[model samples]
Each structure stands twice: as C-alpha cells, then as structure tokens.
Target: MSTVPLIRGYEVVIGLETHAQLSTRSKIFSGASTQFGAEPNTQACPVDLALPGTLPVMNRGAVERAIRFGLAVGAKVAPQSIFARKNYFYPDLPKGYQISQYEIPVVQGGKVGFFVGDHRKTVNLTRAHLEEDAGKSLHEDYHGQTGIDLNRAGTPLLEIVSEPEMRSSAEAVEYAKALHALVVWLGICDGNMQEGSFRCDANVSVRRPGQPYGTRREIKNLNSFRFLQQAIDYEVQWQIEQIEDGLPIVQATVLFNPDTGETRSMRTKEDAHDYRYFPDPDLPPLVIDPAWVEQVKAAMPELPSTMAERFQQEDGLPAYDATMMTQSLAMARFYEAARDASGQPKLVANWLMGEVSRRLNTEGGSIEASPVAAGTLAALIGRIVDGTVSNNGARQVFDALWGGDTDVDAVIEAKGLKQMNDEGALAAIVDQVLAANAKSVDEYRAGKDKAFNALVGQVMKASKGKANPAQAGELLKKKLG
Candidate 1:
C-alpha cells in the first residue's frame, strides 16, 4: 500500500492574502477611467490624483459587487462597517494614507471548503473588505529618472484574508486558485494575473502539533501557480533551516525572486501599531442595508461546486469529467450545448475531453472564440452517433465544419462516409481479407491472438474504414474459422 508523506511532526501553517481589482468601468472614488494599459496619468482625475479640495465618493456598483462576493463565500455581511485610514509613506500611495476597513470589516467569519488528498479541508476566512488601491510607481530609464503611473490609483479592490488553515504550500496554492475561480465566476474580478488584476501574498510558518506557531514570513513576488508553489517550498525549507540552526526565524516581509527561485527578506514585519492606523475622517463609514444584501444574493449565478454536482447527477457525467467542464463557466456552457444537441451526455463528455479540448489547446483558442459553433459541433456529433460517419471520418467532418467548407450533412455526403453496417457487404470484405492474408488466417485458426488483429485491419482498410467495426469483426471471425 502507498503511504502519505509526513513532515516529521512539523506542520506547515499558511494563510493567503489575495487582492482582486474590481471590473467596474470607473475608479472607486472618482469617475476616472479604470481601463488598464492606458498612458501614464491619462486615467487620473482630481479624486485619483488627490488634488486639493477633492472629496471621495463611493461607487454603488463596487459595493453591490462586494456584497455579491460575500454572499457567494457564505460570509456574514455587516450592516454597518467603518472605513479607517491606514497611514503609510510610499511613493505609490499618493494620498499618504489608504482608505480601508480595518477594525470592523464589511464581511466576516466565513469558510471555504476544498478537497485535498481524498478528504475535505475547510479554510476559515477571517474577513473580506473593500479598499481603494494605491497608484503604481514605475521605476524605468525612459527619461533617465523614475516615473509614476496614477492610472491604477483609486481603483476598488476586494482584499480577502483567510485564517491560517493550510498545511502545505500546495494547499495554500489550491486555496488561492479556488478563490480565483469564485471571483471570476461572479464577474467581479477579471482574474488576469499577468496584468496584476489579481495578486496573492502567502504567510508561511512552521509549528509543532499543540504548540504555538513560529514567527511567520510573508512572500509577495509570486503571482502564477508555478511561482506560488516554488516560493512556498523555498520559504518552508528556509524556515526549517533557521530553526534547526541556533538562529530563530524573524518575522518580516519578504520578496521572492523567480529567477533565483528563493525568497529574501525585505523589511522587519510591522504590527498594526507600526502603521498607527486611525479612522479617516475625510471618508465616511460604509453602510449596507439588509435588503440590499438579499438583492445581491438572489442575483448570483450557479457556482462551480453546485453546477458540477448537478452535471454529474442530472447529466450523467463522470465526476472527473463534470469537474473539468464546470471549472470554467464558458466550458460548462459548451458541454451543455453538446448535451442539448445530441442528448447523449456520455458521448459529449468523450468528445469534449478528447477532441474539442485538443483542438482548442493546440490552436491557442478559447471555447468562446472557436470557429466551430457549439450548435454546429453538436450537429457533427449527432451524425457520428447515427452511423452517418465512422470515428476517423468524424474528424474530417469536424475539420470541414470548422473550416467554413461545409455543414455536417454536406461533409457526410461529400466524402461518402456513411457507415456500412450491412452484414452482406462486411462479410464479402472479410472473406477477401482472410484469403489475401493466408499466413495470418492460418495463425488465427491455430489460436494466435495477434493474427486476428492483422485480418481486422485489412477488412477496415478494404472498406476505407466506413465499415462498422463491430459487424466487420464478427464477420471476419466467421470467415477465418
């Protein structure tokens, strides 16, 4: 029997802090454009630039979005939450202090469940709050001096904080991915890591069972899955080495170097007292009515977990296949189309997992941008099910269907690809194949198993693969014996 790996009584404790930029068209405090990839400072307005005599105004859409996310995660939405001031001195922070929810957050005390190693693990969420993001500081030699980009300033971000429930770097990474999927499905964040819409920071520490946790370190240079895994792995080992030596690990902020595949300490980690956090009088507290929370809850779409279960039980898809399809909202819709068109859920699962995904991944195309429409693909599958085309012939028909050359019926008729399931025609081809391969025929008569396959191949080739394989196999056996 295989055994699960252990860490010699040392458990890795992890927590994730994920920040996602909302998808609204305008910034949180001003009507300035929230569009990314614009010229530096072009998207800035008086509110975003922190000009004198400017006041902050909350965006209604941003609040409605936050409540939607809170309900999706089963979090408790506080009827009244206060926005506090977090003071800091960074060039990126034009306001010199960020408007954020500190003590009483908007949503609190929820749990997210995921499966790890044949069991279910629930990660406790401490709180999720809405906050305005700081502007980006660009350090480049374009004009031989550091520059600034206020385009991202004043953007609304949902900061999700989870309790220390993860036991490995892998589990922490999985939890991050789960959150990523939920937010994307909710249409709140775009989940574009390359463009910095979604960012993750992991807090890692080592602890003995029934003992207090060690001094934890935070890593921020990881954004993608591969880098997340590598950074956590490096940090855990580094913590272990520090404890093993006489040196105790210190609490601090750290940066990960993807090039070096290691994490280095940036500065001593600061406590809340270090920032001197106080309520910003300039901005009022956030208030949400209970009725508004109910409104947002009722508007949520079908989440992944619920949809996957329905697909497995109602649509008769395997658990693995259903999980894969529902992981992406777009892919799930495509699978439903295949099922709706053919009414053959099992057959649709096979084609989706095998051919459709293969072509999409090969061409760097998504299901939304596919040249083959879902309804058209469904029509092609129906032709295969009705014996209008053999398996090999189905590929050609699909190519034509997607290539703008012909529809399903046109491809079927143009290539003469209808299956010849008649016993009379199959028997004739089987007889001719056995007589031509007399050596293999004699070997099959003497109980040689491989010889049966050689004769079957010849029968298929003789009919140009339009022959029904099952009928041809039976007829070939009768003629050889």
Candidate 2:
C-alpha cells in the first residue's frame, strides 16, 4: 500500500490560482495588437503603459469569452461587478496599480469534474474573473541589470481560483490540466505554456486533519505541469520539516526553481490591505445584462470531460483511450476524423497512441501539422484490413505516406511489398531451403525444435520478406508432413 508522506496524522492541503491569457485580437482596453514576441515597449499602448490622461475602456470580446468559461463550469455570472485598482509599485507595472476585480469578480462558485486513475474528483472553483496582465521583467542575462518588456501589459487574462481541496500533487496537476483544457476548448485562451499564456500559482499548506489550518505559502508563476508537481512536493516536505522542528510556516510569496527542485521566498505574503485595494474611480463598474450573458452562454463549446465521456459511450472506446484522445481538443478531432473515415475506432486509437504519437513527439509536430492526412491514413489501414499487405508491409507503406509525399498503393506496388499468398509460390522456396539444410530438415522430421522456424526464415529470405507469414507457415507444414 502507498502511504501519504508527511501525514503526521495530517494532510497537505493545496489550492491553485491559474491565469490564462485570453486569445483576443486586441488588448483589453486598447486597440493595440495583442500579438506576442514584439520588440520591448513596441506593443505598449497609452492605456497599457498607464500613460496619464487615458481613460479605461473594456474589451467586449474578453468579457464575452470570460462568460463562456463561467457558463461552461456552471458558475454564477454576477449582474454587476467593480474593477478595483490593486496598488503596487513595480517597474513592470507602470501604472503603480493593476486594474483587477477583487471583491466582486465576474463569476463565482462552480465545480470542474475530471477523472484520474478511474476516480473522479470535482474541484470547486471559487471564482473566475477578468483582469489585465502586467508587463514582464527579464532578470536573467542582464549582467546585474533587468529589462522590462511591456508586450504582455494590458492583455486580457482570466484568473480562476480553486478551493483548497486538492490532496496530492497528481491531483493538483489533474485539476490544472482540466482547467487548461476547459479554456482552450472554449476558445477563450490560447493555453500555450511555453509562451506563458497559461500559468499556475499554487497555494500550499499542511495541517492536522482535526485542527485548524496553518500559514500557507503562495508559489507563483509555475509554468508547466511537471514543475507544478515538483514545486508542490518540495514545498510540502519543507513545510513538514519546519513544523516538526517547532518552526511555524510563514505566509509569504515564493518562487519554484525546477532546476534545483526547491522553493525559495520572494516576498512576504500581502493581505488585501497590503495592496490598499479600492474601487477604481477612473473606471465605471461593469454591468453585464442578462441577454448578453445568455448569448455568450449559448455560444459555449462542449467541455472536455463531457466530450471524453461521449467518446467512450458513443465511439465505443475504452475509458483510458477516450481520456487520452480527449486530453486536447485538436487530438480528439484527429481521432474522430480517422475513426469516421476508417470505421475502425479501435485501430484509430492504437495508431494514434503508438506510432503516430511517437513520430509526432520525435518531430515536435502537432496534430494540426501532421504530414499524414486523416483520409489518406484511413485508406492505408483499409489496405491492411483487406490483406493487400502484411503488417510489416503496412509500416513501409505508412512511412512513404506519412510525409504526404507519396501514394500508399503506388508505393506498395512500386516496392512489390504485396504478400506472397500463393501456396505454390511459397512451396518452391520452402523446398529449396529444406534441400539446402538437409541436417536441419532431417532433425525437423525427427521433431527437433527451431528447425521449422529456421526453414521459415529461409523461405522469407528467398521471397525477400514479401511472403505472407501465415500462408508460408501452412505450406511449410504440409511439405514437412
């Protein structure tokens, strides 16, 4: 049995505050382009840089996309909400404050249900709200200097806060991945981890089950799921050691170092009063009418968990296969295409999980960029099903077809990869092999092991490996008998 470490008769409690940048065409307030990788400060807008004399304006697309997410999670969309100014001074935050929703977020109280190892857990979301992202500070390779990039400033972001209900790192990762899939499916966020479009901030603490909670450490800006798990594991162990040494945990903001597998303090954790949050008098409160909310809700796409269940029930797939296929929207679509074209859902799953995924991983390709078209791939499988080629022959055909450069059937015919199914054709080669290896043939007649396989290999070599294995075995057995 596996035991929960640091159980001290206590459990580790965690909450995740994940931020996903909405994939909108424009900044939340300005018409400046939201495209990434621009020259530093080039993408900065008058409103984004918090230049004086600029009035705050809302982005309708961002608001609508946020509503789509709230409805997808069955959350409550508040009819009215205020955009408060979170006061903090940093070079990146040129305005000296971040315009964010605090007390009255746009949505509240929903649950995200997903499966992990056959068990389903519902992670309760406290709220999801829209805010403007801050600029980035480049600290590395600056030679004792720091560079500020305002490219991300004022870009729209949806901050989803989950309740402290996760028990393990795997559970936290599952919850984070589920939320990531949710935003991507809704077309609200790009869900790009390497680009920092989607990020997780984990709040970790340990407590005796029957006792009150302990001071929690907030680890900010964990960019990958693997890093998230590592950060949580190291933090939990650190907290347990501190408690055992009679050292109380400090409430502080920390950063996780994936290279070192450690969490270090960044700053003391700040309370609401620390930022001196106040309603921004510059911007009016957002009033979302019912009709508009309904429109956004109606436009919402199917959530991932729901789609996964459908793939299992409707596609007649195993739970694991369905779950793996539905991990991303694009992958799920690819599976559906192959399934529809070939009418072989199980084969589609196997190919996707096996060679297809392997090649994709090796070449750093996505489902959208795969060289093999779905229809073409399904056709190749059909050839194998009809016995036009053997399994090994199918692989050669696949390689030729995978580049989208060659016709599969033409490749097979050009290479003469068709199976040698004629009994007479295989019989001639078998007799030649048996004649060449009389001692082995005599041993086989006397019931010696491995003689038959040796003879079979000879026939295969004589036919240049195009001989059908089953038919060759049958002819060889008849001749030997």
Candidate 3:
C-alpha cells in the first residue's frame, strides 16, 4: 500500500482533474479556429454561439487526437460513447450548458506511472472525456462590466479524471507532470500552462488513518506546478484545522491566489446530479471503428516508458538516468545523437545530465534550445577520452563551446589546455621534482603517503597542470621506488 502523508496526525488524500486542450486547428463542434489571443467573439461561429437554427458537427481531427491519446496511455477506447448536456450557467457559457461525455466517456480506465522518490507509483485514471471549453470571463479591462472571450469557448479539451489515490502534494505534482508529458508527447496538447492548454484541479481531503474518506474541497484551475503544490499544502492544513476547531469542512470549489499563497472559497461544489447530465438530443453517439483504432496505433510513437527501458537495456544506464534521459523527446534525441557520435554512451549521458542539463536549467531553457550541439559535445568527450585533455581541461573547452559556435579543437588550441602526454618530458619533470624535494622523498621512503602526494603536487606545479595526473602519479612512483 502507498504511504499517506500525515500532517499533525491526519492523512491527506488528493485526486486531480486535468483539462488538456486539443491541438486541432478547428474547434470540436464548429469550424471556428481554436487559435489563441483573438478578439472577443470573433472566433465564435453559429454553432459555438448556440443559435436556434444551428447544430454541432464533431471534428474528425479532434476525435483522432483522442484516439491517439487513448492508444498512448493503453486505455480502452469505447466503440460507442455518448455526449451529454452538462447543465450549468456561467456568464461566459453561451449555450447555458456544456457538451461533454459524462456517463459513457470515450477513453476509460488507464494508469499513469511516475516515480515518487525511489518508489514507482501508478495513479489510476477514471476516464478521459471530450468536452467543449467555455468562453473566458475578462474583468480587468472592462470598467465594472465583464467581457467574454469566445475564442476559447469552443476549444476542444480532454478532461482526464484520476482516482483519489494521491497521498500528498508531491505525488499530485508528479502525476500532473507525467500526464502533461504524455499528452504533449502524443501531440494531442501543447502543454502550455501559461496559455491554459493544460491545467489541473486538485481535490483534497484529510482524515484519520484507516478511516472513511472525508469530505473533499476542490481547488480549481492550478495552471502551474509550483502553485499546485502550494495550494494543496495550504488546503490540507486548513481542513485539518477546521476539524480540530469543531468547524465542518464544507464541500465547495475554491481558487488559489499565487501571490497571496492561499486559497479562498469561490462557490459551493456541485455533485454529478446537479449538472443534470443527459444524452444530447442534438448530437448522435460517438462511434469509433476498430479499424480506425488500429490505424492510430500503427502510427503512434514509442511511449516514454518503453524508450526508458530500452535505454537501460542497451546503454547500460541506471534506472534513474534512463528515466531522466527520456524526460522529453528532444532530450532523448540529443542523447542518442551525442552517444552515437562519441561512441561512448555513458560519457555522453554524464555530460548531458551533468553540465548540459545544469546550464539549461540555469538559463531557463530546454534541450531544444541548447547552445551546445550534440556533435560539438561528442567532440569534447572524444578529446577527453583520447588523453588530449583532462576532465578539468575538457570543462574549459566546454565553457568556451557553450553559447558559441567555436570548434572544440580550436578552443583546446586557443586556450593551450592540452594534456602533457609525452612520457620522456614528464619523466624529466618528475626527476627534477624528486631532486628538489629530497626531504619529501625521504618522508615518502619512510612510508608517508602525504609526502608522496606533495611530491606529485610539485610535479603538477612544475609543468603548470599540463602533465596528466595519472602519468605523473606513475612516474613519481617509479622514481621513488
């Protein structure tokens, strides 16, 4: 069993609901473009506006994307799924209801696997349903009147609902990231939190260990992973406090304010019955053919987990390194190019996960935006392996290559960072150091290891760090003997 997070002796349980905007050029039910940042109501068509004479036509591209997602996650794509009218009223909703899959969703019963610490966790998914997004409510620019942007109103979304299996905020964020990576990798969503292409709502509840599940309050629209963690942590503590103070934790929807780092109640939560979901009279049932599913499966890219396992088996990398190398398709591709070019898979992995990843993170960029190319990094590692440069000298070459189009050999030559591999020259330097440091040599003959190290340091200093440390150590040992 998975361990639950205990805060002040109470267990925190969490589930997530994520909405991933499909990458179709057109909206789900209309020919309206799903483009972002358009003028309000300009993108809405007759079907999106819910005119009396209009009807919705399902976009084949959107359905194909959903099928692609189901294949990627190993979920069951129902042959027949129904769309229902989710009855609700909001200022931004044009039709006074949302067209969504409620009772019979398109994709059902899959598990997303992620690593939390060292333990591999699989969060069970309930369903991923196709839904039409509502329009946005714009308030800041409108002088006491709200503006509705219908550009997002008819956007296609796959609402992925997870079971209440998460035990803490950390696990929840991991689940979110894994889901985000999966959808983006499948080319279904862009995974842009800033633009709301992918967003999560966390349902949090606290109770005694082994007790019945407590009432859950949903924290809505956490667009950032950092905000997701903060919101859940605060909500868990707030619920525990409420129980202790003899206050009932009411079931309601709340919004997280990132600046204040707190969540405030928005409105009372509604159950499934409150939505008044029913089969849409206007739209027919969504039927996916088995042959169509097979076609999508044939074209699906290799999943991340499958690629990670292959890395372990072929590259001899540890589990963690294999998983991290497959964090994104770009990163994995980079690793492959470097490894093939250098003929040193392990060395390439080291450089990528070490210096390359560090610089990318510091610059707030990704592997796709890296300044160092795979061939250039491969050349640098080759120099190190051929004894042309020490690990220290290779770093110098790497620094010069980063953010520049300079050649590896040019940097090595310009900086004069080549290792002194000449056995004759290094032997002469070792003899001079030995003659100059007679006391150290005597101390070394007297079985003092530090004295021997001092003599080796003298050799490195004499040659100005050009002499390879391994060669120096060997020459010094021969002279002392």
Candidate 4:
C-alpha cells in the first residue's frame, strides 16, 4: 500500500475551492457587459447596483455554461436547483446579501484526476454552483479613499468546491491545473489565473497519522498555482510548529503574501450558519430540462481522459506521453495532425514533448501560438523517417520552419541537410574511420562499447556531419568484424 506524504511528521490535508469565471458576454443577472478592464460602475446595470426598482433576470448563456461544465465533469445537473442569498457586507458588494447557491447546487459530485509526478491522483469535488462575482476594491489608484470596480460585479462564476483529499501541495496544483485545462478545454472559461478569470482558495490543515482532522485555515484567493503551493506548504509548517509547541491551531480565513511567502490571518473562518443562507426571492428555481442536457452534451468536445485513452490504445503511446499530449485541446489536435501526417506516433510525441515544448517554453508562448504548423512539423519528421535528413538535419529544418520558412525540402537543400546515405560513399568513410582508429577498433573488438561510439563520432566528424549516424554505426560494426 502507498503511504500518504508527511511533512515534518504531519500529514497535510488540502481542499481546493476554485472559481472559474464563465466566458459569457453579459452579466449573470443583468444585460450589463461582462467584459473585463472596463471603467468602474460603467458596466454595472441597475440590477448589479441593487437599485430600488431592479430585479435580476437570469442569463441563459450562464446556465448553459454551468451545464457544459457539469457535463464535462460527469456531474449531475440538478433538474431543479434554487439560488439563495448569502448575507454578507463588504465594500465591493453593492447588495447587503449576495445571491449564491446554498444547498442545491447546479452541478453535484464529480472527480478530477491528474498525475502528480508518476502517480495518478484524483480529488473528489463536492459541488459546483453558479454565482455572481463580487466587485473589485481598488486601493492603489486612489489617494485616500478606495475605489470600487463593479465591472466584475454580477459577472457569472461557477464555484467548484473539492473535498479534503489532496495530501500535498503538488497534488493540489496538479488538480488545479487539470481543472483549469478542463474548463478551457470545454470553452467555459478562459483559465487565466493571472487575469483573475480563474482563482483558487486552498483549505489546509495538518494532523498526525491516525488522529482526528486538524483545524483548517482557508487561504483565500490564491491566484497563481506557484503561490498556491507555497502558501499551503508554509501554512502546514506553521500549523505543525504550533502543534509541536503545544499551541492549538485556529481556524481562520488567511491571505497568502507572495512576497513574504507567508500566510496572514484575515478573519475567523465563517461556518454555514454564519452566512445565513436563504432562498432568493428575486430569482426562481433553476430548472434544466433533460433535453437541454442532451443538446449540450451533443455539442461538447471529447474530454481529455477519452482522448488520452485513444492515444494509448490506438496510437501506441505510453500513459505519460498520452497525458502530456492531452494537456490542452490545441496540443492534442496538433499532435494528432502531425502523427497522422507522418504516420509516427512515438516520434511525434517525442518531438512535441522535447523540441516543440522546449522552444515554446523558451519563448514563453503556447502551442496555439506556435509558429511551426503541424503539417510543417510533419513534413520535417517525414524527412527524418525517410532518411532524407539526419536528426540534426531535422532540427535545422525545424528551426527554419519556426523562423517562417515553410518548404521543408527547400530548406534541407539550401542548408545541405540531406543525410549522406549512399552505400558506397558511407562505406568508404567507414573504412577510413576504422583504419585511422586502430586502437579504438581493437578496444571495440575486445568488447568495449564506448570505443565503438567514439569511432562512430569520428566517422561523422570526418564526413562533416552529412553521414547518417545510424548508418555509420552499422557500417563501422560491419567493417570491424
């Protein structure tokens, strides 16, 4: 049996609550535009402002997006779900109470699976509910008084709550990334954590191996995954130290300061009763029809898990490569296009994971934004397969392709990248290598493998890198015998 990872003799339990802002064009309860970066109060409708005579009308697009998320996660879309008013007062909230889902959320009970290192981990989701986002309080731009940006207010959000199943910060980040990818894959959200399109709150605690659960402190608004991991680790250590010194852990809502790498208590964590949730009178019960669910499902794209399985069974890729390829929808489509064009699955996986991913990361770009087209990459890989270019030659062609040159064969010719595969020419060079490196040949004949590799390198160097490395190695072995 596998053991849970312990930090300083304490098992860390982490639960994550992620908010994926729906990519609707309008607010959840009003006709105000939901576009970000708008001027404060410019986008706030009367309903968002909670004016005297305003009532919120539900956005069908927002509910459809929630249905999309639910179908993507295999969660049950409650045929009849009610919205409730969660009583709270803050500078950013125009209304004294916020409309949210309390007991009957729209999406209920799902599992998110992701790989942490080599181990596949899964976290159970408690519920995902539809709600309106609170406005942003801006303090930096104003001199003494804070300004409120109600543009984000009334924006649609699907608040996904997870069970306390993650044991380490790594698992939590992986789960967050998987869910982020899923939402982006489903086109429900943009998955931009930096822009606040998606955010996560981590509930963390530490306990000894068989003891009752420790008190959990909620870390609010971990906007980045890096911060999410750092905050949880720091909070776990602090809690363990407190317990070691015979001090009790207090439950509270905390904020992670990325600069200090520490968590500061914000307020005492509020329980359900503290919020005083009651069904909202302004909004009626959200009733989704079974046919609507089917329509959404029919339009849904294939999920990552299903695509990964197909990559494994049909393309003969390993689980790791399959998972990596399915990290995003665009990447999966790119890999499939290249693999089908080249008729090489493993080679396509290697190139994408190695050269393609490395180049994209170095430039801080995404696969969707890559300059090398799938068909172009396929052509380059095809050249390598047909012995038209060596592996090094393929890299040269790929570089040229990324730099805006499209014709693979033309680039190969201009760069003198075609491998020297002619039998007579390569055999003559192999003979020269064998004759010049008698000592190395003796070592290889006497069973040293490194000497054989050295001889192969010398032959390639002699041929000015035109000789195919594999062909040289085979010919060199034949000549030695």
Candidate 2 RMSD computed on C-alpha atoms after optimal superposition onto the true structure: 4.6
lDDT of each: 0.83, 0.87, 0.92, 0.92
lDDT of 3 by residue, 247-311 (tens): 99999999999999999999999999999999999999999999999999999899999999999
Give the TM-score comparing model 2 with the true structure, all chains together. Answer: 0.82
**Model 1: CA > 4 A from native:** 1-13, 49-54, 111-122, 142-144, 167-174, 206-214, 233-248, 259-261, 396-406, 412-418, 432-458, 461-464, 474-481
lDDT of 2: 0.87
| Tens-place lDDT digits, model 4, residues 1-481 | 5489888888999999999999999989999998777766899888998899899999999999999988877789999999999998898998988889999999999899889988888788899999999998888968988998888889999999999999999999999999999999999999988889999999999988998999999999999888999999899989999999999888899999999999999999999999999999999999999999999999999999999999999999999899999999999999999998999999999999999999998998889988988988899889999999999889988898889999999999999988999989999988888889999989998999999999999988999999999989888877777
Which regions of candidate 2 are displaced past 4 Å? 1-10, 49-52, 117-119, 208-212, 389-400, 403-405, 410-481
Judging by TM-score, tell me the better candidate of 1 and 3.
3
Clash count, one per candidate: 1, 1, 0, 0
Tens-place lDDT digits, model 2, residues 145-264? 999999889999999999998988989999998888878888889899999999999999998775677899999999999999999999998999999999978899999988799999
Ranking by TM-score: 4, 3, 1, 2
What does candidate 1's lDDT look like per residue over 1-481, in tens digits? 3132336556788899999889999888889888889988898788876789998898888888889888888889989888887888888788888888889998897877665543556798999998988887776775876788878888999999999888887788778877887889899999989888898989999877668988999997467877888998899888887887869888999999999999999998888887888887777778899989888878889988789899999988877777667757888898898789888887887877788788887887767877777788788888777777778899888778767854788778888888897888788888788778989988888999999988888888999888987778788766655
C-alpha lDDT of residue 102 in model 1:
87
Residue 71 lDDT, candidate 3, scale 0-100: 80
